[model samples]
Target: MSTDKGQYFNDLRTIQANLPTEYSRTFGQMIVHYYLHLIKSSHTQKANAKGLKQQAAGILQEFKRKQSLRKDYPATDLLVWVAESNHLPQALPVTSLLKEKKYRVTYISNKQQLLANPALEGYNKIQVVLPKRGIIAEKQVKEFEAVVSSIIANTNLAIITAEDIDTISKAFREYVTYTRQLQADYEKVITNVNPKAALIGYDIPTEGRTLTDVLNAKSIPTFMIQHGAMAKVDGIFGTHISKTIFVYGEVSKQVLKDSGTKADIKITGAPYLDELMKKLHTAGSKAQGKLKVLVAFSGPGHLTTENHHKKSIEAVMEVAKNHSGSVEFYFKLHPKDNRSYYTAEMEGKNLTNVHFKLPHSQSNDIFDWALFADIMLTGASTVAIEAMLCRKPVISLDLTGDYKELSFVKEGAVKLISDKAELNTVIEQAVLQNFDAFDASSRKAELYAKQFYGPTDGQAAQRCAQLIEPSLN
Candidate 1:
């Protein structure tokens, strides 16, 4: 299994260097993000390339499609906060708390559907940034296409063929056009809103970069919020253009530092975790029926194979099937995961107590699952950290043996397990015992968790608000 990008990343970096400085800053770097996701979960080059060509063809089609719109943003004086993936639950309390501080925050989302979320209901101004629009300027295609060919031809990739470069180059041109449209739309937003300052999600994502670039040129300081922990290949980390990045804790801050991050990092805690912190301090009594077990699905690609992810779920379901009388299982999917495929798997099973939770912007989040379950089961997802922070026991299920030792596990905040039989045993014992039986383990988990993301006083959002409030005036 290919644990690291190895030669492929070297090849891509070579391409990044080949592109002219102008395009290299945005589009060239975007090329890297595209491939990072492409093979992010695939542990082997064989698995990674299984459908890569077809995927590339599809991406070309998507690039050539109309995905954004041109809009005349109205004039305003609000401080614009652009969150593509970091909407509602993730940006929580920080956005709301800032509003309370009298910062008229205009929330912009790239996911068009997020504006309707009930969690964002009380917000005064919320809008969606259309993801893409029809191709804009065809004016400068040949020159960039030549640059694309030069970059592709010179780079020796572990995946993709010389023949693939032709299709890929065309897509690159389309992306250039799409990115140009994004630049135009954002410029319009700037001209109309005259944003006070800016706050964005990740430093990656061409969309976020376009916004940051436009905002930066206007001397608007942009702050990025850290929603998840950083892994080595999560993306290009050191290349941030934001003035500063707001992180969850020192652990994340240190990781960013090691990755050569240039931006100043402020540990503001995690707003979602802060909510869990409040509930952790005064958790209501557990219902007296079956033992509640929550299975938080995360990192099928980054941590395990898609097949192994399925195996982990099957293991949980089997344990539930065997202990139906004593235990209930809740499967919480990552927002990017599809529920329909899993829905079909549960169709014929008589596992009546098995529950499925589809988490959206405003719906039940991982914290709610952590709070409601007696024991949490995951594959070392970031949720394991969040669940532990909520004072819940977390078991990391490893199927392909591709597990890495994260700090939390070394700190004993999470336990890594592989045997399915052992999973059944844990469920049976916990269900047969008192609800408080796992209380000691839960408390122990919290001790390590505090070191990971602590001060569980539930003020992470407040801390972020305090930092951003000063720049408003």
Candidate 2:
């Protein structure tokens, strides 16, 4: 299982480094194709070449089917692009609210999860733009090669291997063909839809960048909505091509300003958080018992190595062991993490009080977990902010000093602990006493919410709708 996971992650890194970021989803599909080929090759006792050809043919057929479904539609007032199902919630509220005002809103995504989202059913249209698999024409291929060669010759990427170059070349060829096809399809849709403005969840990824580039070329206004907490201001939101960016709070807006980002910034808060706050306001408190400590695992991006994950889990288990029967630890896994990896790591040692929870299930929503947790612990997850919004004390473990600059620590929203001793002390204090009962911590939590997430009122969606209304008109 570890070998399988390692190979899988290595493939992911290769694809991520070589292909356009938007193709990350397509890379998963490619992995499925490869696995199918491997299984067939093993069953037939034959060379894998035949299976590879079969997989390619199958991908081509599906690509052609998706392409055949493309057709012209009437003009729309607004076009919203969402990359994943998780982004659907942020897009839904604004689109739904806009629909009431009679604006024609259309949604587009390459991900099936988003296309199948029930929340997007009320939109004017929902289109899925699947990536195509095939070689481009010889002339276009030559032109692409020449362009890449020039870039390689002049760029400072001095340590790339021949294998890396070959991988990048192949990936770039696919990206070029796929993006051109997408551009053609999107151009037709935009021309027929004739949307005055387009709204995207975030504009840093390759998909958003490519789509935004297309829309900007046609002089259509574009807006990027804040989908999550911004650890820093110099990323996608800061340097995106969108004319306007809708953030969740003044803090994010000010961060952009300090970073010298050239875009109109608006604080609409977060629609999902607004709704969660409403539920939290009415929901009953957790039943009193052993103090529940929730530890949120940062995703693969931050926990880059298995050792990092192992060490983090070890730290939490140590705390749980120290507290024994007095406190319980709930380990919340990141959505993108493989559950088996953590489960295998914790199979022995018998930490009886430690429990694992998956992300985004009925019982494990960050907000729900926050409500049940007396104190939340994490390295640098957005859950720190969510926990604070739920009135839970947050202990940010910065053992490696990676989280020192994060907004939660920098803004005094959480208790930052850099050493094991400090972590133990903080956890003991949190478990023994009502940490939220302290006036200073309560005030700090409130300030964190205000600075990080503008308002708790359930009008964030309406506010976003109002911002897009003028663009539609």
Candidate 3:
């Protein structure tokens, strides 16, 4: 990478390091949802309460729509809140994927606008606004606290640690900013616990704070999740969470020991990834047509701290030109990002071999495309991990920033790069390589699942449900 590019990547990492804990990512989402609701309700380009009320109304409609599903299954009163991803396959597909495995699922989050429209009425789902039995408010700290406190009065909390605080802080604003307040509240909850443990999804939310202080405050067992596959540079991976941290792989466990987290950790794999692994096993259905590779365009506000997304896209375009005839390359720009962002670089050039996917294309369709593709390409993403599990070869180019330092991509598991030249070569290799050649990597993906999670039998939701079944009953 050139000096300028190197500096850019360095700056990106610095911003990532400063990101609020992952818990904060949800808060950012809420703010986005709040504003978006405001925008759509007014039907005007202006921002005001009218628009916000419209957004809230839309969410309420979606909640009622989802709630309608339970009308027939009265015995199933417990609300299952699956996180809604506006990016990859919305919450419906997630719940559908879970249902396929015989687990009943529901929608519970702020992004309920997607489900409110008449177009989604074909699907039977119930959404609860308030005064409902369950709330899937992942980052809605105030509401989440109230609900958890009511149900799990004996609930314990934990915080997973990494170098990124800004990202987490932005997502879980109320929880992190009001740490002392939350800590005091949690103390009251931990007073009643004996055998039950509440696993807080602390995916890299603890950074600047001392792990020991947080862990000690909650005498209740506080558990954490290993963010990704481990490698050298994951400073003190297992040492930060309570004595019982949940890791994805043995490498992560070893890295934790190397970092000095002496907590007795368990390998719960990744609860977040359980849905993806299920897709991999059932993808034997041969998919026809072009082997597609999707490049998700994320802006500086989300995913990247630096404005290198266009540069990365240009590099992929350069490589796509090489095999455009046989292999297909698609770009899914972030909802917030637009084509104008790349006006200078892609203005005159029209690469017939490449295509740009608008936000209308659901993330689930992309995942389905990933299933049929000969290989998948990305800059730096957890999506690469999912691609690997789907048995597709992955080529992760380090277009900019501290991508080389990420624990998951650092391993040879993902192909990293700095510019168009390197990405071109990686893409060429990925497209031509035989699928069978990746059996070992796929198995490693499975092992990554088992070591961290305990099973890959497509029953992760069922397994998770098993843990919470008695509570619901």
Q: Candidate 2: misplaced stretches above 4 Å?
A: 1-69, 133-174, 282-287, 302-307, 357-361, 434-442
RMSD after CA superposition, every candidate: 6.3, 7.6, 11.9
The digit string of per-residue lDDT tens for model 3 on 229-328 reads 3544333342244445655556666667765566775554455555566566776433455556767544443234444666666677667667777667
TM-score each candidate. Answer: 0.78, 0.77, 0.51
Clashes of 3: 39
Misplaced by over 4 Å in model 3 are 1-197, 203-218, 224-232, 235-243, 260-263, 272-279, 282-289, 296-310, 321-326, 332-345, 351-366, 399-401, 404-411, 425-454, 459-473
How high is the CA lDDT of each candidate model?
Answer: 0.64, 0.66, 0.45
lDDT of 2 by residue, 193-228 (tens): 789899986665556666776788898999888756
lDDT of 1 by residue, 367-399 (tens): 677777778888857888777666667787776
Question: 16, model 1: CA deviation in Å?
Answer: 2.8
Order of quality (lDDT): 2, 1, 3
* lDDT score for residue 157 of model 3: 17
Query: Residue 175 of candidate 1: its Cα lDDT?
Result: 62
What are the clashing pairs of model 1? 2-43, 41-301, 67-132, 68-132, 68-133
